[model samples]
Target: MKSLGVIVEYNPFHNGHKFHLEQSKITTGADVVIAVMSGQFLQRGEPALVSKWTRTKMALLNGIDIVVELPYAFATQKAEIFASGSISILSSLHCDTVCFGSEQGNIHDFERTLAIMDSKKEEYDLRVQSYSQEGYSFPKASSMAFTEITKNDRVLDLTQPNNILGYHYVKSIGEQNSPMKAFTIERTSAGYHDPDFNTTTIASATSIRRALFNHGGQIENVQQYVPEGTYQSLAHYQRQAGGFHRWEDYFPFLKYRILCSTPSELAEIYEVEEGLEHRLQQTMKESHSFDEFMTRLKTKRYTWTRLQRMCTHLLTNTKKEMMQRITSTKKSEYIRLLGMSKKGQSYLKQVKKDTDIPLLSKVTAMESNMLNMDIRATCTYAMKFPEPARSEWMGLEYSKPPIRYNEETNTFI
Candidate 1:
C-alpha cells in the first residue's frame, strides 16, 4: 500500500485539518495516511484542550488510517527537535512521502533556505547568537539571521509558525537522507496565531481553541469551522462530561513545583537553561495566575511558549539527565500506536514485519525508560479532569486497550 505520513497535533480535529488530510491523500495519490501526533502536551508547551484518546478517535473517524503518539519527550520541544523526532518516526515506518501545511507553499524556497542553513551552520549559529545576545527570541533571531544570509524576503516566511515547521521537516528529511518525499499544502484560512473566529469553514486551530477556552466550551461557536463528525463528536464528549482543559487547571500544581524547587533543582529539569532558572524562581515568587506568570515570563529572548514548555518539564519532573540520555541515543524512538482503523491495523502488520523498533499497540507488553515520563505526564493530566473520568483513567495507560476500528460495527471501539 502507498502510505503518506503527516505530523499533527489536531488539538481538536477541525474542517481545515480535514481539508489538509484529504488534499494530502489526493496530492500524493496514497492509499493510506499515517499520522504521528502529540500525546497529551503539545509542542507549544501546553496541555491539549482535549485528551489524546479523544483526539486520536477523532483522527481515525475522519481520515487518518493510523495514529501514532509522538512521545512527550519530543512533543514538547522546539521546532527542529520536534520535526526531527516526527520525521524519524515516519521514516522508520517506511512512509514514502510526508505532507504538512504551510502559509507559503513554495518547495524551492524551503529547499533554498534549508540548503543555506545546512551549508553555513556555523555562520548561522553565530548570527543567531549575536541577535540572541541582544535579547531577541531564538525564532526571531534565526529569521533575522536567515534574512541577512539570503538577502531575500521569502526567508521572512520562516517567521510564520507553519512554514517554520515545514522548513524543519525539510531539514530533518535532509538530515536523515531518508527516501521520503516531502510536500506542502498552502494554508488558506486564518493564520496560525489568529484567535478570532471567522465565519469560514477554514479557521485556525488557535481560533477554534480560543473560542472554546474563552467562550465557555460552547461547541456551537466552532461548529461551522469543524467537520460535522467533529462537531457532533465534540458535542457528545462535552455532554458526556470531563473534557476541555485550561492551563490554570494545572497551575496550582505547577506553582507548588516551582516554589518547592531550588534554582539548581529547576535547572536540572530539561530545557531550563543558562540561568533561566533564576528568572523562573523570581517570577514564580510574584505571579498570581498562570496567565500572569506567562506574561511576566515572556521576554524577547525567551518566548512565552519556550518558558511554558520548560515549566511543563518541571511540573512533570522530566530530568535533564533523562532527556540528555534520550538525545544522545541518536535513533528513532518506538512507534506508540494511539489508535487505528481496520485498514490501518492491516498496514501496521506489514510495518511490523519490516521494523525492529517496538510497535507499541499494547502498552502493558513492555516497559522502557522512555515511557515513564509520558505515563507520569498523563497521570498528571488526568488529575485535572472531573471525577469519574479522572478516577477511571488515573493509570489506565497500562490497562486501556488500543482503540481499534470495528469494521463490522462501523465505529471505533
Candidate 2:
C-alpha cells in the first residue's frame, strides 16, 4: 500500500483538517495516511487544547491511518527543526509522498524558492544576520533577506505561516535525501492566524480555539467549524479533563517556575538567550498572568511565538544541552506510535521490520535521551491537571498503548 504523510497538531481536529486529509489522499493517490503529530506541546510552544492521546483518537476517527508522536525536542521548536523531525518520521515509515496545506499551493513554486535560496545561501545568511543585528526577529529578518535575494513572483511568500512550514518540509526532504515526494494543496477559507470565525465550516484552528476559549469551553461554539467526531471528542475531553488547556491555565505554574529560578539557571533552558533570563526573571515579578508577562516581555528581537517557545522550555525544564544533544544528531531516535486504524496497523506490520528506526509502542524501559525528554514533557503537561487526573494522565506516558481504531466498528478498540 502506498503511504502518504502529513505533519499535524490536530489541536482539535476540525473541518479544515478533514478537508486537508481527504484532499491529501486524493492528491497523493495513497492508500494509507500517516500523521506525525505534536505531543503535549505544539510547534508554537503552546500546550495543545487537548492531550496527544485525545488528539490521536480524533485523528484516527477522522480518517488518519496512523498517528505518530513528534518528539517534544523537535515538536516545539521553530519551523525548520519541526519540519526536520516530522519529515524524518515519515521517511522512516517509508511514506511515498508528503502533502501540506500552504498559501502557495503549487509544488513547483516551493521548488523554485528552494533553488533560489540554495543558490544564494551564503548571501541570504549574511543578510539575515545583518537584519537580525538591526533588531528584527529571525522570521522577519529572514523574510527581509528573501526579499533582497529575489523579486520573482514565482516563489513562495515566506511571510505566510503555512508556506514557511511547507518550504521547510521540502527543504528537509532534500536535506535528508529522502525518497518521499512533497505536495501542496492551497489552504481553503481561513488564514493560518485568523483569530475569529469568518466562515461557516472551514475555519483555522486558531479561530476555533479562540471561539472555544471565548465561549468558556463550549463545544457548541466550534461545532460548525469541526467535524462531528471532533466536536464529540472536544466535549469528551473537556468532561474528562475538567477544562480545555490554554496558556492561562498554566500561568501560575510557569510563573512559579520563573520566580524560583535564578537568572543563571533560567539561562540554561532551551531558547533562553542574550540576557532573556534576566528579562524573564524581572518581567515575571511585575506580571501576574501569562498575557501580562508576555506583553511586558515582547521585544523587537523576539517574536511572540519565539518567546512562547522559550517559556515552554522553561516550564518543562528542557535545558539547551538536552535539546542540543538530540538536534545535533539531526535524526529522530524513534517513531512513537500513538494510534492506528486497522489499515494503519496492517501497513505498520508489513513495514515494521524494514523501518530504519525503532517503532515505539510503549514508553517503559526506553533508554534514549530523546524519549526521556518526551516523558518529561508529558509529565510537565500532566501537572496542570488536578489530583487523580494528574496522576492518571501522567501514568498514561508509561501505560497507554497505541490506540487501535476498528474501522469496521468505527470506534477505538
Candidate 3:
C-alpha cells in the first residue's frame, strides 16, 4: 500500500489537522497515512497538553493509519533536528511521500528556495552573518538574507514558525535525496501564533488550546473542524481536575535546575552560546517568571522561540553533546511505535524485511540500552504526575492498546 507521511504534534487534534490529513490522502491517493509525532514534549520546548497515548488514539480516530513517536530528543529540538528525525523515521517506513501544511503552499517555490540555498549557500550564509552582526535576530537575519536572494516578498514571512519548519523539511529531504515525494497544502486558519478562535473552516491549534484552557469557547461550535473522538477526549480532560492549561506548573523544577546549575554546566547546555549563558544566569537571579526571563533575553539577534527552546533544553538536561551527535548522525535504526492499525501492521511487515531499522512496537526494561533508555526517560517523566494520577498515567504504556486495522474498508479501527 502507498503511504503518505506526516510529522505532527497534534498537541490536540482539531479541524485544521483533520483537513491536512484528508487533503494529503486525497492529493496523494495514499492508502495509508503515517505520522511521526511528538511525545511528552513538543518541538517548541513545551510539554504537550495531553499524553501521547491520548493523542495517538485521537490520531487513529481521525484519519491517520499509523502513529510513531518522534522521540523526545527530536520532538523538543530545533527545526533541523526535528525535520531530520521525522524524515528519517518516515523514510525508514518506506513511505512514498510526505505532505505538510505551509503558507506558500507552492511546492515549486519551496523547491526553488532549496535549490538557491544549496547552490549559493556560502553567499547566503555570509549575508545572514552580516545581518546577525548588524543586530538582527537569527530568524530576521535568515529571512532577510533569503528574501534578498529570492527577491520574493512572501519569503520575508518565511521565518514564521510553520513556514520555517516546512522549509527545513524540504531542505532535509533534499539533502537525503530520498525517493519520497513532497507535497504541501496551503494553511487555512488563524496565524501560527494568533490566539483567537474566530474562524469557520479551520482554527489554529494555538487558538483551540487557548479556548480549551480558558473555557470561554464552546467545543460544539468548532465541532465540524475537529475529529469527533478528539472533541470527546478534550471534553473528558476538561472535566477532569487540574486541567492542562497552565504550563508554568512545572516552573519550580525549571527554577531549581537553573538555580543549581553552574556556569560551566549551563555552558554545556544546547543553545547556550558565549554571552547567552551569562545573560541567562543574570536573568535567573532577577526574573520571576519564564515569560519575563525570556523577555529580558530576547534580542534582535535571537528569536523568542529560539531562546525559549534553548532554555527548555537546559532545563530538561539535554546535553549539547547529544544534540551534536543527533545532528551528525544520518539515520535512526529504530522505530518507536506510538500506535498503529492493521493495515499499518501489514505495511510494517512488508517493509520490515527490507528496512534498515528495527521496528519496536513494545517497550522493555533495558535501561542500559541507548534506544530503550530514551523510551525509559520519557516513561519516567510521564509517570511523575500527582498521586493516583501518576499511577494512572504510567499504566497507560501497558494498558493503552494499539490500533487494529480493518482491511475490508481499508480503514484503521
Candidate 4:
C-alpha cells in the first residue's frame, strides 16, 4: 500500500490540522497518512499546550492514520535539521510521498528556489554570513541572500515558516536522494503567529494555544476551530491538576536554571554562542516573567524561537558535548510509534521488515542516547502538569500503548 507521510507539531490539533490530513490523503491518493509529530517541545521552542499522548489521540481521532514522534533533538531544532530528521524517518518508512502545508502551494516553484540555492551554494553561504555580520537575523540574512541570488520574488517565500519548512523538506529529500515525492497544501488559515481565536474555521495553532492558555477563551470558544475529540481532550487536561500547559507554566524552573547556572556552564549548553551566555545571565536578573525574558533576549539577530530552544536545552541539562555526541551518532535513526490506526498497523507490519533503522513501539524495549533525550524532556514536562497527573504523564512514555483504532467502533481503543 502506498503511504503518505506528514510532519506535524499539532501543538493542539485543530480544524486546520484535520483539514491538512484530509487534503493530504485526497492529494496523494495514498492508502494511509503517517504523521511524524513532536513530543513535549515543539519547533517553536516551547512546551506543547497539551501532552503528546493527548495530541496523538487527537490526531488519530481526526484521521491521521499513525503518529510517531519526531524525537526531541530534531523537534526543537531549526527548520533544516527539523525537516532533515522528519524526512529521514518518513524515508525509513518507505513512504511514497510526504505532504506538508505551505504558504505557496506550488511544488514546482519551491523546487526552483531549491535549485537556485543548490547552484549558488557558496555565494549564498557567503552572502548569508555577510548579512549576519551586519546584524540581521540568520533567517533574514539567508532569505535576503537567496532572494538576491535567485532574483525571484517567490524565493522570498522561504522566509515564511511553512514555506521554509516545505523548501527544506524538498531539499532534505534531495540531499538523501530518496525516492519519496514531496507535495504541499496551501495554508489558507490565520497567520502562523496570529494569537487570536476569532477565526471559526481554521485557526493557527498559536492562536488556539493562546486562547487555551492565556486568553479567557474556554474550550467552548476553541471548539469552533477544533474537532469534538480535541475539545474533550483539552477540557479533560484543563480539569486535571496541571490544566493546559504553557511555557510560562515552567518559567520558575527555567529561571532557577538560569540564575543558578554559571557562565561556564551556560556556555557549555547547546547553541549558547559567545555573548548569549552573558546576555541570558543578565536577563535572568532583570526579567520577572518568561515573556519578559524572551522579549529581552529577542533581537533581530536572535529570534525568540532560537532563544527558547537554547533555554530548553539548558532546562533539560542538555550539554554541548552530549548534544554533539547525540546528533553525530544518531540521524533520527529510531521511530517511536505514538499511535496508529488499523490500516497504519497493517502498513507498519508490512514495512517493518524492510526498514533500515529501528522502529520502537515501546520505550523500555531499547536503550538509545537519542531517545534518552525524549524521555528526559518528558520528565521535565511532567513536572509542570499540575499534581498527580504529572507522575502519570512522566511515566506515560513507557506505560501507555500506542493508540489502536477499532474499525467497527470507529473510535480509538
Task: Report the lDDT tens digits of candidate 4 across residue range 40-62.
Answer: 99897898888898888888888
What lDDT score belongs to each candidate, Candidate 1 first? 0.84, 0.91, 0.74, 0.85
lDDT string for model 1 (1-413, tens) is: 99999999998898889988999999999988899999889898899877788888889888888899888888898998899889989988999999999988767778877776777889888999999899888888988887787774345267689988999899888888889999999887677888786656788888898898777888888988987777877887777654577788899899899888888988899988889888887888999899999999887788888888887898789999998788554355688888888888889888887875888876666677777778888988887867777877766787777788755566876
Cα displacement (angstroms), candidate 2, residue 151, comes to: 2.0
RMSD of each: 1.8, 0.9, 3.1, 1.7
C-alpha RMSD between model 2 and the true structure:
0.9
List candidate 2 stretches off by more than 4 Å. Answer: none
Best by TM-score: 2
- Candidate 1's TM-score reads 0.95
Alpha-carbon lDDT of model 4: 0.85
In model 3, how large is the Cα lDDT of residue 200? 74
Global fold similarity of model 3 (TM-score): 0.89
| lDDT score for residue 32 of model 1 | 82
TM-score of each: 0.95, 0.99, 0.89, 0.96
